[model samples]
Target: MTALTIRPLQPGETDLFLSYPFPRQPELWESQRDYVALLAAKAYRPEHTWVAIRDGVVVARACWWTGPEDKRPYSLDWLEAEPGPGQVELGTALLRKAHETMRNDEGRKPDYHLFLPPGWRDDAMVRVAAEARLQTARNVDLALFVERYSYRWSAEQDGLPDRSDRLEFRPADDAQMLVVLRQVLDGSLDAHDQRSVAEHGLDRAAELQLEGLYWFPSPRDWWQLAYTGSGELVGVIIPARNYDMPTIGYIGVVPSQRGHGYGAELLAEMAWRLNDHAPGEAVGADTDFSNVPMVKAFARTGFRITEEHLVLTDTAAGK
Candidate 1:
């Protein structure tokens, strides 16, 4: 019997971190030079990435990443382990060891978010890779939080979503916006929001969601609160963009107004507004798969399934 060794990469040990003995499916990261650039961009740091080695060979590696302006890691999203005996235990130990240090530094462990292609379970290679990481996460006390369904609309293919006819939208300032943001969380279908509401309460939950929406590059004023013919509030919609693509950032209906197909109305209005800004460009949006109405709304708005994001979170850490 042998024990696997766990440790973080020392500064400038890019190659050593890359020495793990398995090929990544979808293979979306780091050549040595590109990794150097990511370090420079503050997207990744050596000490935040960890690996497990036995007999001088790397068997498992876990990487944490941050937003462009963030100094601390935001998510532990990439993980890999060689397939063999004790592989699961080795990977679990590796993640637990890295998380122990990270939690002490950041006051919490970041969630594990893994992206899978559509119909991933049908693909042998992808399923194995996904399962290995998922099992490791559970072993480390993380739970399967939710599966977010991703939808995209292309002006060139799917065309624009229908403009809202029943609702009039007007921009809300930060203070006024907080009102609707809080109201929408009353009976929210969003798992992240539910968790935030459970742990942080309603006001803080809305504030947290608003805080995340601000991280996008889109103008803050693009957020609009929708109202009916008589000036009654319906919901809120945000047409925004991230570093990657144009997006329908946030769309929520207040608890009192959930049943009138307003979610789809908000989705359509967001698409129209975003298309106006990013003309001829594709737009992306996501909602929890459990939110059936929102999922149907994406279909009604001419969006198609592109990919799904599998979000995993720690029970010990909320949001």
Candidate 2:
């Protein structure tokens, strides 16, 4: 048996990386090509791309990328191994080696993202493949933190529910938004935020939320504070544009006001706002699978589940 060599992609090895005739069964070759092109355009560092070789033949590969306009690496974006008798082992070893090479001095593991079909859990073959991938990730200490269900609502899906006259949405400044965010942080069901609060504490979690919202490309007018007829704050809705399409970035009802049917109303208001802003473009949103209340709210607002994602992170499970 030939020993496997795990190392970073060498300079000018783009052609070599793209030449490996890896099976593209699960992923379209075009999509894979686009990813490689994106990495190249973004000037992805050679150290961030890794490969596994056996008998001088590339067997597996992985890569990472930084956030838009940011230099530090943000996520592990792509990973694949040629299908063969020992593909699983090769893939797992390649991933582990990549993680080791990329970890910060503080021992923080980079977050990795993977999108899977919604039915992967029920189908036996998909389940097996998904599990193998997950197990390989676990070998490098990346564990599944959350499963997010992707939803999108277009004018064609179903007519938006009539706006409730009882609910009024008023533009909120950053200060006001932060106040609302603090309220929603208490006992939040959002898997990402929940984990953030558990591992890093409430203040840090809130800080991250504020930072994300502050950097949102949409105008401040797109953010709103939902209030009842009597002017009591019910929740907040952030309908912002991602790149080009409008998206329901964040919507949450305060813990004290939850379960009073405010979630559906908040979501409906967001959809109405986006439709009025763009008329016909699709509005997208994602919610943690465990967040049943929010999921039902999305359904009520005419949002359909279009995709599912498995979000894996290097953070220790629940701290």
Candidate 3:
């Protein structure tokens, strides 16, 4: 057997990366065809894509995506291998090598995210394909950060949850909203929030969140501060647009405002706002499974789970 070689893709090699025969079992968000379509928009860069070649045939491939305004890759969305033996090891080496090259002296390595169909475990083919890539990440020193549920608000299927009139929403800029964002992090059960606060401190975590929300293509005026009728603070709701659809960029309640059934209401308001802006369009949302309240809020607000996400953060040095 020719020795395996792993490296990032060079210019004009998009087709080469997709040459691997990934079985078309279950439909996923990271479908190769869809990714190829996104390539025209520059959502992916060749330098950030990698493949493991054995005997001149692509056996493994990993694709990373950076935000529209980012210069470097942010997170990996696709990790796949041609169906056959030794594919797991091939995947592990490819990821390990690719991580080091992509980091390029940056302190943080890009994380990996997988969007699998709901109840994917019940399908033997999907189960095997997912586990193979997950095992590769574990082997390369990436830690499984969280399992999150991806939901969609369908106008026809989910209908619309009634918007409560209890809370008053006031338009606020980043400066005013910053304070509330910090307050909500006090006891956040969201896995990403917890990790950010712990590793980067509350101020940084809150700022990072604001940056993320700002990154969306949503309207600035849509950011509103939720308050009680008498002027007490409840939280914030930012109905925004992601790449493919409208979404609730954020719906957060301050620590003091917990347990008031505010989550469901806040979520409902977010959806209504989205509906007002993008009529007849679906709204996407995600919440870590650890965030029971958020999960409940999603369900209560008529958002149905369509996909399960497995998120892994890379802590390994680019050696």
Candidate 4:
């Protein structure tokens, strides 16, 4: 038996990669092809896509990607291996090789995102495959950092809830926004942002959070701060466009102001703001699965779970 050989996809191998059968999902080939092409045309490079071969047969493949303006890879988005004897071992080896090639001495592994359909947990094969993939990445020192339920809201859903109209909603300047972000950082249910605050100080974490929001299509004026009639800070809601659609970029209530049903109010305010900006367009939001309160808040605001995702990152990042 020939030993496995793992390496990145070479130049001019996009066609080969696209043609490879993706384990079990034959119906998704067309969509996957289009996505792979888009990535290649944007941030994809030979070194960012990897494949594992045994006796010259491709057995596993993986790829990393970045946003259009990003200078380096941001995440590992694709990993698939043939399901056969020793499949787990091959998948683990492939992921390990990719991490070694991409990560530096700091052991910074790019975030890995996996989207699964709703109710995947009930399907035995689906659950097993998902667990195997996660464990494979874990073998390479990446851990499951967070799981988020993707939610969507349309104008057809329940109209935005009405709370205290006296609670003023106003556009916040950068300074004020940063202050609010800092105040809510400690008790934030956002696993990624909380982990960022823990690993790097609040300042660095805030910078990263702001960096992510910069991708929104909505302008700065769309970012808002909510306060009381007496000028007390209630919370902040960032309703902006992501990619092409309107989204609740971030919404949080001040730690001292939580538990007063402020979170649902904030989400409602965000939905109203986005509706005003892009009338008749759908709005989207994601909440960590562990954050039951926020999830319920989203539900109360008419956002339904549309999908679920598993996000993995370097284990050290969680420390």
- Model number with the top lDDT: 3
TM-score of 3: 0.93
lDDT comparing candidate 4 with the true structure: 0.76
**Candidate 4 has which clashing residue pairs, if any?**
none
Each candidate: how many clashes?
A: 0, 0, 0, 0
Q: How close is candidate 1 to the true structure, as a TM-score?
A: 0.87
Candidates' lDDT values, in order? Answer: 0.80, 0.76, 0.83, 0.76
Model 4 scores worst on lDDT over the 10 consecutive residues at 25-34
Query: Among all windows of ten consecutive residues in candidate 3, which has the lowest summed lDDT?
Result: 24-33
lDDT of 1 by residue, 13-90 (tens): 888876766755662222112556666777778887888888888888877877776667888866778776666888
Between 1 and 3, whose lDDT is larger? 3
Alpha-carbon shift of residue 170 in model 2 (angstroms): 1.5
Reference-based lDDT, residue 296, model 1: 88
Structure candidate 3, residue pairs in collision: none
Q: lDDT by residue for model 4 over 220-276, one digit each (tens)?
A: 888888888898888888888865479889988888888888888888888877888
Could you say which candidate leads in TM-score? 3
Q: What lDDT does model 3 reach?
A: 0.83
Any residue pairs clashing in model 1, and if so which? none
For model 2 the local lDDT of residue 117 reads: 66
TM-score of every model versus the real structure = 0.87, 0.85, 0.93, 0.86
Give candidate 2 regions above 4 Å deviation: 3-5, 9-13, 27-33, 40-47, 103-107, 243-245, 276-280, 315-319
